[model samples]
Target: MMKIIYTLFSCLIFTSCFNIERNCNDYKTGTFQFNYMEDGVEKTGKFVRTEAYSIDYFEGKIDSSSVRWINDCEFILTNLHPKSNQEKRSIHMKIISTSKNSYTFEYKYAVKEGNRPDRVVKGIAKKIE
Candidate 1:
């Protein structure tokens, strides 16, 4: 019947979505820049990870902040002096596309405001050697 057809159709879509290959270890090493949009302005920054466990994320002209990763794709960005909401921005970066010399990543910036949800940013980073 129609009901049987609808149920089977929905299951096909759901299963396909869950099958994408997601291994974070292969996608995590590089120097990346944030071409993220904040308050309708494009903000730029550089993130340098000497290895998998250590990184220095820098913004503006010359000031840089060091951060550490929990794993290949997840890391905590922190600031020492602590000013504005930038100090506590919870960032999660996931790889979407990869090639010989670059990768496209999708990221979400968690918000603390009660009325709004997290903001998502996506960009491609070229590998630096």
Candidate 2:
């Protein structure tokens, strides 16, 4: 039992030392591209972000959203001109890890209603400019 406990403790220590790199500041204000699946088809979208707003171009449709940063790695996006009740909802996004030109992120609806489960989706965005 002692040997088993020692091995488990050592494994936990080593794994805890491994950390994911998050250089979210480098991607705060830039043009980025990401892919998403729509009706079983893969589609790519691009967006331009500044300090206060983000403009997205997808399938010839343009959308603008307000950007509110919670911290260096987290932000909330609210549509500036929501077309429907669903669009009025805000999204919460977090930067999990980053590479040289891309960052992995997870996003979900910012607010939840009673009896509704949370659904988070992860994606990678590559900086273009």
- Give the alpha carbon lDDT tens digit for every residue of 1-129 in model 2: 999999999999999898788899999999999999999999999999998999999999999999999999999999999999999999999999999999999999999967889899999999999
* Error of model 2, residue 93, in angstroms: 0.5
Top-lDDT candidate index: 2
Q: Can you list the residue pairs that collide in candidate 2?
A: none
Report the lDDT of model 2 for residue 57.
100
Per-candidate TM vs. native? 0.55, 0.91
Name the regions of candidate 2 deviating beyond 4 angstroms. Answer: 1-9
User: After superposition, which runs of candidate 1 have C-alpha atoms over 4 Å from their true positions?
Assistant: 1-27, 33-45, 52-60
Best-matching candidate per TM-score: 2
Residue-level lDDT tens digits of model 1 in 68-125: 5666666554544446766556556567656666677777764455668777677876
Model 1, residue 41: distance off in Å is 8.5
